[model samples]
Target: MTTPHPTHLRIHQLAGLKPGPKLLVTGAVHGNETAGVAGIERVLKQFDAGELTLLCGTLTMIPIVNPLAHRLQRREGERNLNRNLRPAPIPQDFEDRIANQLCPWLAHADVLLDLHSFNNPGPAFAMMGPRDNDSDLEPFRHEKAEAALAACVGTGRIVEGWLSTYALGLQRRAARQGDGSRQASLVQDPHYGVGTTEYMRSQGGYCITLECGQHVDPQGPEVAYKAILRTLTLLGMIAPGAVELADPNRPIEVLQLYEVIDREHADDQFAREWASFDEVSEGQLIGTRHDGKPVHAPSGGRIVFPNNKAQPGQEWFYLARPSDRKLKP
Candidate 1:
């Protein structure tokens, strides 16, 4: 048998004459979400046509992070490329090999714009990191800067508390096991919550995952394109006023994720067709558990990422409440 070769990522880099913060933009971390790829291509086309110029700093764009998955038009090749996105010592899986190359680039950047699209119907939003904290799992000191950058991304909604809440869910799951021992599985790994943005935060860079819209939504690509231009202008990589930014007076809604519900069985089902951002009342019937028990909402909040096809032991949905955190101007 012949030895297999590792896959490499296609990266586009442009450097300006002046020095500034290094900005990294990535697309299609989940291969099926091609909006980012389309948006990045549009920007590249402008560069080729001499319509856009980088005034300062370095701009690195990886139009497709998971080439194998993208080629197949699937969410992943071996596993979800977005999860556990850190350089691995062994580089075992297909994603691990990709991470080995991706992580160094992440660490070298001053900021990152990870573009993605959701599976459900909802307005585009930005997923940001928590406020500056010393947490060992996912620590960062760029909340204000992240928020400012996010505001210019044309999204009115910002959601935080992803890694921290996932860590909390893992703790609860371990507690339920009653053996005080955690399983040695990908989902159970303490750092399982570490994704592209989380890894960037750990490297001291401001980052945001902009969920453009539904995967197949035609407007998803436009949102991604506008976000890219806005980010370039906001970060001074391009001239100020080079592109239109989000309305300064637009009301920004911040949400903090608090709960992640895992599918306990293959037969678990949602009560109805619930969409992301659908408000759930306290004690409302959210779904039916595998054991024929009703799973009610623990509190009044909005449902996020409601996955009807999640496998057993996978995250089925998440709950979030409005956050009072103030954003910087």
Candidate 2:
């Protein structure tokens, strides 16, 4: 096994023959979301002719960023590995230390693809900036950006909002609405933000996020692998049409990444088996704290990814707004 140092987190790289641009792909920033790791593993194993050509740029692949989280099969370091990217106190927690080293690499990329999986059964989708989200990929880059996102996602469901606002803002002049010509979904806040992908865009790079599917699902990792292959194909980093792909259009919904409920202690218990996208009744008891206190839903909505093996302080469950299925967005 190769040791991953801060300077070289890249597990593999197929530098292009013609140095045009750099396309970086990362996986397993979150330990439990093993889909990216598995996806990259398959890509590495399937070495064919012209698998990753430096046709236009260099390709770098980092399979695991948070080994600690992977070791425990949980999200890493008390703080989410995606956040805490700002210039912070030099000496801090494990994630911060890693961020201090990694954030720069993410920010410095020319084009980056950060792979992740969700707790819920999710359609493969692309997560981008707020219409107001600032990014280095802003201005003249909207068309290509949208096209890139569109090509990566089998579904049309794209994410925008606070993620673009907070982390995405770090890259550009400041994401203000009614500016760019591209009519992207102007989201104020979606669920997750300040993640590594957002941070990369902040540093003047083209970065996109891919949610492969439910993390624990056996096919989840394979789906992510397909995503990686497709994305590289779109970027012209590999042979065109290298693999057959899934073309599925999903309804677009702004995912407001809510707070995570963890189930570390044995005392934590769910009221019932919650399914992904299950409709919920307001004030219904979703689960109980380790102390046996009732945890209820605040409103009538859908339950997103509901994890049963969350670490004591990590996210165990999440809330989501289900599509009415009547109104088309």
Candidate 3:
């Protein structure tokens, strides 16, 4: 077996007002999208400079989760680190070890904010967990979540898939338990299921993802600043006066997006001039086949994560979000 790369996990403790809720804020899970790095850095500075107070809980931040990727300025390591987490019997990679450690830590938190960014030039938004475990009747919980998201990063669009995937992972783990205690208990442990969010949820922690904005946009820094303020307010970690929104959050549509996987050989190549969230027309050329051929989209709206570096039988899956514009046809 090959040895995994060593990834050092750094922790920053923001000595809040005595004992308080713990919040885990991570950014740059993907090396290429680094808007969160700036946001996190700024937050740490503010906390240190006495600009923001940790009203109730701990604020822990990991600015860059993918250190190697950041160093390489690429999305994934040569090893597809993102897919190496969980259910692997043995985590045979550096990423897995980090996940194993991080998952457990995440479960202990009162709340978690997984900071991320897209490769596209678009508005920012938030992604929530699929299960509405918090009482549905509470307007503040749901509205606060939506408003927090809308206020932050400013993109009103919300994604339903990541949370759903997390919940499903949890449910699967629960169903596989032979013992009643282990079975029922794991789901409550926060790190029971498959995802970072699943682990957070099992630990009874409220977790959400903040996708800042366009990877290379300089404006991304400013956007992330806004998001951090809104998140702090929405979580009730700060006073309402601490967060003064420039304007009311805009209306955003909830999207049920889907993915298209790619299965191609290494030698066979396709051009990837397409950008993430780039609009696509039906039957438009998407890429080339593994055997040096072209592949076209049978159904399309947006082309997400278009890439030529994808491995064979691995997800070259492209995400498609329904267009906001009215259909011409």
Candidate 4:
């Protein structure tokens, strides 16, 4: 591996005597989410103290992926780093430079675990890639492996259709305009939905974006820590008894995101404060439009990723319905 730029990312690679799958774990892709950072540091400390050892393969950890945003303790130093995460031919922004360094690492991995924390209150859940599909943009052929990995992360809830739904949202936005005008903003980009896990999947690797918990939750770091250990054990990088796995028979709830609501007006307000996974009836009033028109739930389901700070044309929230997909044993 090449030495990274001093200010870009700090990567720690641990190799075992035997060759096995290369696993990459990343944290702090968003500056405000430090649970993954704390968890990764804890694991590194264990390794440094000779308390933990990699039995096989390589373990690469990037505890802080976005250093500038992390230093300022903001979501982004320039723009959201997670959106449109690909190496730039001619780097222009702070995150583009980061992506140039990060994308190579992602492409080299056999597996990826991206740790994150949400703003709105919700249970920890894993965001999964689509099932084996022939979609040229983000073809996913390892759904079973990905599902098993997500199941082992101790998150009882799993959600899918992230890139698919985002793509649909972009299409809707373009159709609403009818004109062929394309904006230069991040959200308006065709590749805006290509985030970390999506990029990993595109590289033919199984990946999971584990949302440990709320940003300020005291137990978020511990959740992330346990998830890291469990993933290491699951991938055979560590011994089985190194960390306790969740019950094999534990029921896992799967949700499929079908709709992404983009903020039409800057002043669009929710009917009340809403959190992720909050259930709503079909006729329930979710919020009010810019013109005082009511926005109600289109169907009976739960809300996901409700961003109260979204700007106009940005994704404000998503609607998800129960999925019948089962995790592989």
Candidate 5:
């Protein structure tokens, strides 16, 4: 774990005269995903320039959640902050400390937008985790309403079942290593989404993680900016035409995540530089195992979050398929 710089986490807030939904937007939870932070800055500039106005409720933005990591141009400082979002009696690491501090405000918000960017180049999408009837998501107990609200951001792509993938990945890893702690944790709270958005959802708020695009994509920041504005309009915090909707008929492409592939040994390697959303056929050779055996696709699907730099015991990529479910604008 690297020592973080002694910088204070800052939250920018804007309040309107009329009361409405409280919206929380977080950027740079993973420091490498900088576009979100830039997007927040751009939006703030618009507000200061009188180009955008808050008609009701409040807007809170945390431009850089992991400042030290951001400064170092790395993904994280100590550990993945997004993974340690669950409340614990004592903070476990640097990210845990920040999560604990942010918990109260997260619980109070009516909605949350967690901004992020993927390592593998791809189109922008909005990710929503599973929330069962018994889950802690209070106002968003209905999945249909949640899907509609998420699609309102106009990202045009929606990802589902991340929690299941996370659990499946962990289960396979644990099974191979004969470990049980992660499995135990999953059993204890199956709904825990393992990210900032998931933490917000657990606190009875509607939270969406908008993956703008590849980390350094030029269009990433602008996409994030538009998403925030669209969200404000959707929440009725601003006039309908305050921000021109980019796509009048944005059709959300819903994907069901089913598998997460992990690099279990140093010798395991991907066969090619696969980008996110790259489609693969059944039995397609995707990589090579530690013993030089070929690794093939289990089914026909698209690969996402593929990493050429994956480490042993870490996720290398995920597999998903398009589903009939969609939210049409």
Candidate 6:
């Protein structure tokens, strides 16, 4: 809070009349995802304009977490700020400096909403922290709590297992013929593990990342705005009756990100223009590899986060499967 105006890690706070849970909402970890930034700005303005009242908790908003990258209109500045959130002995880059400053806030908050957007056109979805099997953690340890928090975000579609999916992708890449050296180099890349929301969960706090549709979609900001309101109500930070929550009986689609397809060869290309959430049949043609080999869907599932412009050796898309789980909260 002592940081001067225009600091990259800008923070705004509102204290309630009574002490309660501390909530931190962060936006633009990736600089190009500006909807969350705009949404957080609007939320703060509402607080200042007396349109929204804080009842019993602290609300802190960091509208732009990675200001330098955001200013550059890129996904990152020197590096992807989302990954490797652990403390560094010395700040190495722009994101590192930002992380060192922001991690404390993440550690102290009872709840966190890390806002983001996808590169491909897609409906809004919420990404929750890893479950027991998702990480090396004990079985079923964080699943219930993480699912509960994710459900409150009202995205209707909740995803888990991002870390697991990324790990599997790396493993597959490591198995490619004559690619061992490249695999070793890629594994050493800092953006390989838990991101912001997952890091918060590691600290015993609940966090959810809201992907508010495509980067440039106008609805993306509206999705983020409603998500924040819903989360505030669910956490009792805002009056329950003041804001409408999602219908309890409303159908919710739960998914586990199972596989991440990589564009391992330069000539790899998607078979067609595929948007996120597009369902594909088993054995359906998803794309083609550099060797003129066809890549078919291994199973019938919905494809999420499909990126036509993915670089070779990077994730081009992910396949998600349906889950029958219900949240207790």
CA lDDT of each candidate?
0.88, 0.62, 0.60, 0.88, 0.78, 0.79
* Arranged by lDDT, best first: 4, 1, 6, 5, 2, 3
Write model 1 residue lDDT over 212-247, tens digit each, in one string. Answer: 999999999999999999999988888776577789
Candidate 2, superposed: residue stretches over 4 Å from native: 1-10, 19-21, 45-52, 77-79, 86-89, 119-126, 133-147, 155-193, 246-269, 281-300, 307-316, 322-329
Q: What is the lDDT of candidate 4?
A: 0.88
- After aligning candidate 3 to the native by TM-score, how far in Å is the CA of 240 from where it should be? 3.2
TM-score of each: 0.94, 0.68, 0.71, 0.95, 0.89, 0.88
Tens-digit lDDT string for candidate 6 (276-329): 889999999999898899999888888998888776766788998886566663
Show where candidate 6 strays beyond 4 Å: 1-7, 132-142, 173-191
Clashes of 6: 0
RMSD of each: 2.8, 9.3, 8.2, 3.7, 3.3, 4.1
Candidate number with the higher TM-score (1 or 6): 1
lDDT of 4 at 42: 96
TM-score quality measure for candidate 1: 0.94
Residue pairs clashing, model 1: none
Please name the candidate that would achieve the greatest lDDT relative to the true structure.
Answer: 4
Judging by TM-score, tell me the better candidate of 4 and 5.
Answer: 4
- lDDT per residue for candidate 2 within 31-123, as digits (tens), equals 788888988878876754435444667777789887666766777644567754554576455665666667666665687778888875656
Candidate 6 displacement at residue 8 in angstroms: 3.2
C-alpha-based local distance difference test score of model 6: 0.79
- In model 3, how large is the Cα lDDT of residue 80? 41
As a TM-score, model 4 comes out at: 0.95
Candidate 4: worst-modelled 10 consecutive residues by lDDT = 175-184
